[model samples]
Target: MPPEPPDTDPGRLLAELIAIDSVNPDLVPGGGGEAAIAGFCGAWLAARGFEVHRLEKRPGRPSLVAVARGTGGGRSLILNGHLDTVSLADYDGDPLDPCIRDGRMYGRGAFDMKGGIAAMMVAAARATAHGPLRGDVILACVADEEHASSGTEEVLESFTADAAVVTEPSHLEVTLAHKGFAWFDVEIEGRAAHGSRPELGIDAIAKAGHFLVALEELAQRLAQGPAHPLLGTGTVHASVIRGGEEPSTYPAHCRITLERRTVPGESADSVERELTAVLDRLAATVPDFHYRLARGLHREPFAADPEALIVRTLARHAEQTLGHPPAVRAEAFWTDCALLDRAGIPCLLFGVDGAGAHAATEYVDLASLDRVTDILTATIADFCS
Candidate 1:
């Protein structure tokens, strides 16, 4: 028999969350979706007096929005945390088994980011236990953050909040900004002919080398460019490449899929233009070079006003909880905070301290989990009141 759900204690809540397999199916074939975990969370919230709403726009892929309605007029706050995790196959031990040792909880999603999810869950319950605040406290346990973030995307379509906090394991620090990403495909065209007839065939694979070299040059140029105060400069690199099928015949096409990590000022359009310029230059300089650049998925970078009400409130609580000012930091990776910010909801990221986000080993500091819970509870009370 499975273990029962824990009480309001953040550490126990985190353990229960870790024990549930909420791996993103989009990332791993036949992986456990958010169904089981979403059900658990929904029941947990419903039992605690939250009006739980389960969103399953995509069948079998559900996201939960649990709300504690406010009594009167006050700014609502959204506490966001993804319910899905990366593949657990590579975990060093039993991925689903939550263990505690040396004041740390070890499990696949313990750190990134069931810890944050548990903290926020307990915090929201605690903050509104006595009575409803003037503003609503909404806890969003969304799906698909590991792959497409379709869960958050769907949530934004129906819900909006005055402010939000993404619990994404930021080492108990305040993360005001994070890098975005843009994907692109560069297909190089070439003439197919027998290998012996070099004169009749244009080698697409060889031509791709030119683009790869140019891409490196572009990366270097980006490195030399002016950097964002926290996020630094944007970066580009080839992620996947497919070319010649066999050595007996000349290949007709070579496709290169690359990803560009962008700072605040950069966008998919900007990155496309940069790639276009590089390709155009190569076309003009390299002989028989023909190619097409196609833009793929993209997400915008996020930057929060350090002076925003939510930021200040959370930071103050965090400082009080830690007995020291929480350091303001930035992440190179993307998060749902970007989506919330783009939707005009002011948001920042703050969560428990941990390591091994997608590595073979993972763990979250038990003390930090409790501290984060205290910080979030205080912040929610102060901000929503």
Candidate 2:
């Protein structure tokens, strides 16, 4: 049997977590990583008599794992969350400023994460305080989730869990699936020449312009393709572009950055092959207009079995605790849940209600935070039982 849930102070834990500046560099420059937050969590869990391990994938970027043992009768459940936020440089506001007003906690990572981390901690605290459970429970908090997914990847490589619940802000919905992401940089090369002598040399920018048109056409084709039942169709868009050195000279090279959303059955290699074929055909038309494709992040899509024992148990708990059956769906965004899913673990994404993540005035509803904690606590108990 699972231990009785203990009274946990989730609000104080959330405030303390929000106070730490664990914003990823892509979200904020010069902001510290997850070390401080991991340290705090380590101390908190240790003081609660839970077995805790602190793992650092990179210096100053720490990931923590805390475990509570139960009756050793069932598979383990992992509660995973990241302690990172997107860069807050343009906000002109303090990233660490966690202001609670009108039932919302305003902070850089309050919604995108931290809130989930707080709820996990509260659940873990209650589980520890109540006594032994029916099975093991692992609480994992990783770093660099806002930028690169290396943090969660490292965790998956090092540990295994039967099932995982990723605490990514999902408006308290049970997200059993999420789309993958593919990033690429396309570079067009050409000969530089004087602008006055246009006929003497090839213009890289002109070639790049043509290539952009082809890419746009491809994007449209992808958007119109058959959509995935849950995740929808893939999406392709050029996010950044740069080229040309001088106004009076034909540029030698141009580059465009693309972000592509991948649905189920879409692999990074397949996407590359398709794009390569398109560019190859274009190269045949434009003389000496060769291009190179550099791949960036290639996160895989993740889906959990709704019929899995842990998932079903959690869904029941959600309905019982939240007064409504949990909404099951797939997120359009990529998350660390994919990493665990790829490792053969059933993963689900769920968390607090909020808005404006990675934007100015990001905040998490305090009431939702409390509710999430309650849900987490009950879910863990049910899963372990």
Candidate 3:
């Protein structure tokens, strides 16, 4: 294919990416995940003469790594974003439909972040067309970000970069750090018996109620203390619970799912241990009140070095392009940046301006999209020059 246009308008690319549904592994029912978006990115990058590598962690879920070679003197800069989005499966409207209204792009991943991916793509294309760069530009569009970051983990296992940028929805600001998350399911076991003979059996539902109270206390304590400078301390909340089976019979078992946010310097293992200790203490009170804890989703907190070259370069570019100095912030939610950071890459988060991520009728401002593209292009030039 003839070399793709140098000035690859990001708007067109955003529309194309939004049209592809690459919902994450957890969100997808049958586990076929992120393949469509990966295919589109791979094809698009390859057609633009980039050296593209496609990796699959599972069948039909692929991640793409595209490289533009330069003078090869300095370390490579990794421009990363996930292809998978939070499932729109629950959405009543068509998730794949990309709508433009009043200069805004309305779609499932419009802001968080097909828009960011489009900016990266356009920046890479522009840099390639401008001739050889001083350093390599690596574009990593991965799968499973909305779930467990399997694709990012795969990248971390095999690849290393000097610095990295994760294109999450940061409202065009620099995100130097973010809190991690741990999800778990706790099961309390008890004996079941007829309602008329309630004294003959132990009630798991009652035990669960006590445990929930303890969890609430734990959450409150963490919230009031242990605040981090950026990400704050931590948080815990019981998201779901199930116990009783029938009204006529006493329930035998209860399961509660919880989500815990961890700040920097906190480990998922530590959080699990703390929770287990709480359960053990409760078990001492009730002999048959034993509970088992199983971890589900676990991600560590990530904080990029504020003085890293990539972060500084991007901040400067944002100021130049948008005429305002980018403010550094922390996200309460988690992203694949944690995976990359653990892999020893300094990862900063930045993206287009938007709101209502993962909510209905998600939209991204057209002006923000344009500004992101311009800033990204300039950052790439600055880094590779």
Candidate 4:
């Protein structure tokens, strides 16, 4: 069970969160997991009179969902934020030590995005301050966003709402779309022979060089094909390559991994087809060219309807709070909002300002955190009540 809500300032709550190491184990072996933080958040919500449910799809990996039960009369809203952060590999100072300087709270997961979690948590508490809500407000503090996103993936199996807001760092803008990425591994096979025997050996590395050239051509063609108004054209790039053992011997195999950042219209199948076309052309001309293409991980691109109910509602509230409309922008990184949107939740991304997530130093803008909390609090009251 989660502990009782601690009597502390909102910024201090964020500091406490930063002090806890919820680094994704997938990113850093033996890194602290989300169980402790999830428990704390769940308890905090429970203390605020929410119905808390602890979900653990994988062993030791937990996500907390706290719901304020409603009369089933108004619209339900989901506030989603992940609990895991990347490894602190090269951090300049102690990544877990939270400090305040120049009106910024500096620490790991502070900006990207314990600050958002703190804001949403406080907002939920304040929304129900007067009385019970007409509609349910679900607080989804999940795990595993940094690596596989298995936490949100697991939650989507059952939990849902009319709309959702992912509190990912967005510089306080409304992020309506983001690029998705797919990883593909290509293997080229050739006959091994002594390097001196050029006629007897088929060079797989040389063949890969041809594919690299073709990849550039494919990139050019893709850049010229079409573009998303917000996301622009898709992109493809070679990630890593491995082949050859000794200089005296012709390596029998070459393996290459490539990544494709997809825009709205692209899919894994489409990407595979495009790569197959490249290999097909090479096969027609290059002698002894044999290879196989295998698809790895893929996350679909997300694009929210700018006119969505959640979008309009958040915008109105944000404008009322900021004295101007929040900018609607696109993100280069992906978020769990894509999964929520795919499940018909009409979710959008929003968060505070700061930088240096997974970097040497990190922090969240203290003022932005307070502003986001106030905006979200008012938004919940207006939309759910």
Cα lDDT, model 3, residue 14: 89
lDDT of 3 by residue, 230-288 (tens): 88889999999999889988888999999999998888899999899999999999767
Instruction: Please give the TM-score that candidate 2 achieves against the real structure.
Output: 0.94
lDDT of 1 at 224: 100
TM-score, every prediction? 0.98, 0.94, 0.94, 0.96
Q: TM-score of predicted model 3?
A: 0.94
Give me the candidate number with maximum TM-score: 1
Winner by lDDT: 1
Candidate 3 — which residues are off by over 4 angstroms? 1-7, 30-32, 89-94
Displacement of the residue 34 alpha carbon in candidate 2, Å: 1.2
TM-score head-to-head 1 vs 3, winner: 1
Kindly indicate the candidate among 2 and 3 with the higher lDDT: 3
Better of 1 and 4 by TM-score: 1
Specify the poorest-scoring 10-residue window by lDDT in model 3: 1-10
lDDT of 1 by residue, 242-286 (tens): 999798889999999999999999999999999999999999999
Better of 1 and 3 by lDDT: 1
